[model samples]
Target: MELTFLVYDVIIQVYAMLIRVSSLFNPKARLWVNGRKGWRQSLKNKVPAGGVDIWMHCASLGEFEQGRPVLEALRSLYPEKCILLTFFSPSGYTVRKDYPIVNHVCYLPLDSRKNARIFLQTIKPKLVIFVKYEFWFHFIREISKQQIPLLLISALFRPGQLFFRSYGKVFKQSLLSYNRIFVQDKNSLDLLKNTGIEECVIAGDTRFDRVLTVMEQSKEIRAIDTFLQGKSAWVAGSTWPPDEQVIRGCSDLISKWIIAPHEIKEDHLLYIEKLFGEKTVRYSILKDAPEKFTDKTILLIDNVGMLSSLYRYGQAAYIGGGFGSGIHNILEAGVYGIPVVFGPKFQKFKEAKDLIYLQGAFSITLENELKDVIVRLGNDLFSKSAGDICAHYVHEHAGATEKIIRFIQEKRFLTN
Candidate 1:
């Protein structure tokens, strides 16, 4: 089984290298994937390195955010230690390559035995933390062999997953290597114990911590502030076409709207612009707009990395991805005291159900019902009630980050 897994890892690595060739056409991307090691290494060692090295790995952008607060919490609690972040996806690594807190941010080389051995030798992290749903057997076993303390942050489990299946002994054994399992919910804890693993605790989600930190950074958000101009704005984040269609149906005469599509390709943006025509304004065209944009009916945020913070400016947020599309994080909007609306399909997300039970969130399967909900929000009483409900939901659900951090600290997992 181990040898077969190693062979599969080599194949995946070769495929990833082939994808790097796409960087030739996109030079900036080429630079990131190709020069990751030497360039990143040179910049990282300038910091003092003799202390404890805590290494955290995540699979992609969502996992990165899920693990971010823990990373920042570690830095604050243990300034003497060096932190290293390993991302298996180029999308996550490239977007976050410049984070100052991470001493080394690079690709988690494919988990072949040879590559895993080399990685363990290179950073030699005293502790390895894997963020939610990113368990690779080869890497887990190899890291465990070094007797490094392993922690799983914001881990979540469902019955349908391999770990719960009848033939899951191999994968279940891989999880046994963890010093502790910090699951996100009671459901996950139930699943883990059913598999005969007991080292589990409920730590909620670290993304809540990350969203709170983003709120702190947005305390003086001048850009989104000007765009909002005291009018009720709808901050649509990480949206797909189904979401856009629903928002368009209701936003024709609304006071203000912000449409940030997931894709920024020329064709995509132009299609979006035509959907609303002159009523829309792109951020790139802000230079040509009058000094003030109080009259701007719709502002299209055409760039990436700014949508989550922009949610702070919204009166009510409609998080895109649902219906047939995968759902985006509605908690980000909910944390800022705004009621979040999304598509009908959200079975995998426990937070969605909790938020709905709290009346902080709403979802619709039908397009026509969306209009009624929007019109209802026009009432001052309904809007205030929704906002207050959402804020209360956020307040009640915080402190997961502290729980996970305390677990790692009490274990004395990270060395100095």
Candidate 2:
């Protein structure tokens, strides 16, 4: 265990050095390096003194979305408490730093013993919450030593994960620091229990709650509506290069397509334009000129923060990223009652599996399979039925945030 901690500490320091080196040329890496430059001092200055401070740590944008509902709910429930949000990734911090709900949003300092001590001591949180799978050993150990209320929400665990492995004893010890863990499924709960840690609840995923909030707040975008123009449109969101190939292969099957590629880099945008040709209009170009897209068959999204609302204009949707590492959010489209399609490598996502079982989503491994699914969903009855199933599945799993809030209330953790 001692040797493991030493090796892990060295690896973390090496990673920090790598990020600093990469920041010289990489724009995103530069943001990451600059973001944490004076985090401790900045946090000290911004965080108010002498109040119940609740801190939430998220890995990135997705985890922030997963934790947003609980954060908002906590704000409403305890108006007097200070809400501190920290992100380990630049993606989350850059996008949500100005998020109105939290008092402050900043990049978390690197996980070292000294950094952890300074962060916790300066922030002096009454309670600490970790979103999804973030388990920083140094932070956890310090917070545990202080006996602060530490909770992990929207957590999921699989049997083959490290915590269940033979050499995971040291890693498993980190789980002991959490006061309570609210997991996503029964399998997660059982997995933790089997490891002899039982302070958990099967409260489902809070992302359902977040997506529900999105559905409520969604508004009409005139240009997007005009682009659709009452036609059955297929919206493909967060598509990688591989996913774009799948879309290109089936382009002939659909007359109207809206694609939002994962990266909006110049090279990527040019590639999409070259593939789709003159018929494709970049979203940045058409937000003010909806009439420009009248002759265009594909409206290529070159911006961010609009994909969720755009799903409302689709008959069916293809969620990207499945062709690579993992699938992006399917619930964003699913909540809008649209049948979703993704690549076959979506087994790790519980919602994808559940949606597949409920007939709300389809996973296609090949280009031909995607074309066939598109054709099948073109039928009005089949489309509506699948759409209904998608929406219903989201609605059914909508109360994890409430359940978590209720648990917090029962524990009397909120300050008066």
Candidate 3:
């Protein structure tokens, strides 16, 4: 415990300095928002105090989406309970700043003993939920010490995973504190047994359930509607710079394309503009640009909060960040019934391999291969074959949410 505190102290100082120098406002400013009544008062705008408080913690934006169904269930089942969400990253916090379900959203401070205590004290949650892979020892210890229930949702584990391995004693022991663990796959169950912590259930991934919900609610874009009046559209979602470079290499004579980067920055927009300078790049939301896209390339996605929805507008899809070891959610594309394409390096993502073996998704090792695949998809011989197979693959794997929601409700955690 002392060693952990020492490590945390050393880490938080550097974090504080980073926050000071960085451009964005620190979302965890509330943790240090004590002693100054005005600042403390402003940082933590008042939240409902008397309701059954349920606090959910996520590592980032993806996990937040994974936790959405559970959040929705709680809201529907116990409307009186005040839901609070804390994100460990700016991406999640910024993306979900206006999420309808959560009353209070803020950054989980760099976990130190003092910050942990203050956070738990303020939220005073009846239950604490950790989505997927955020296993903070101090946070869990504080929740356990406060005699509140802690749950892990949609979790996965493997044989060589540190928790089950010989050296994972301390981390494994820390997990024993949770009242229950709801894992996504059976492999996780097998791994947990090796640790002798058998109080877990195969609850499946809630993200599938969430993504299905997204598919059900997905809206077609007006600009895409105009662009794809006749031609089949290839959509790219959450791509990075390398992904954009590959997209730009595609010939302008192809049917039509929508390129949505994972980021929508001024410099990124400029880089994309430089690449597609002659072709038209539409600002998705603004839509006030020139009228050259009828025979041109649509380069930049100046819009925010709409990439997931835009995947619904394509016959073929390419998810971003594959080139830089960051695989965006292929399942988002999968759910839309589109044959997905991505870069070669996707070993860390099990779904990528699953999609590849299922005989529809393509993993290209070279940019030329990407060009070849695009050209092939344009050909009349093999378009619908892969598209139908991809759709079938996603259709068969859609019940991860039902498993998780049933577990949470049965345990009576969200019940007021």
Candidate number achieving the greatest lDDT relative to the actual structure: 2
Better of 1 and 2 by lDDT: 2
Candidate ordering by lDDT (highest first): 2, 1, 3
- Which tens-of-lDDT digit does each residue in 159-192 have in candidate 3? 7766776756666877888888888777788788
Candidate 2, residues 1-416, lDDT tens digits: the string is: 88988888999999999999999999989998998888877877887766337999999999999999999999998886788899999989988999999888888999998999988888888889999899899999999998889999999998788889998899899998888999999999999998989788888899999888898999999998888778778999999988998899898788789999888988999999898788889988988989767778999998888899989989999999988999999999999999999997898899999889988899999999998999999899999999999999999998999988888888887654
lDDT, model 2, position 35: 89
lDDT of 2 at 142: 95
Off by over 4 Å in 2: none
Count of backbone collisions within predicted model 3: 0
Clashing pairs in 1: none
Error of 1 at 353 (Å): 1.7
How do all models score by TM-score?
0.88, 0.96, 0.87
Q: Would you list the C-alpha lDDT of every candidate in the order shown?
A: 0.78, 0.90, 0.74
Alpha carbon deviation, residue 282, candidate 2 (Å): 2.0
The local lDDT score (0 to 100) that residue 251 gets in candidate 1 is: 82
lDDT of 1 by residue, 217-280 (tens): 8664565567666777778887777788778878864688877787777887887778777778
Candidate 2 yields a Cα-based lDDT of 0.90
Q: Pick the TM-score winner.
A: 2
Off by over 4 Å in 1: 1-52, 220-229, 287-293
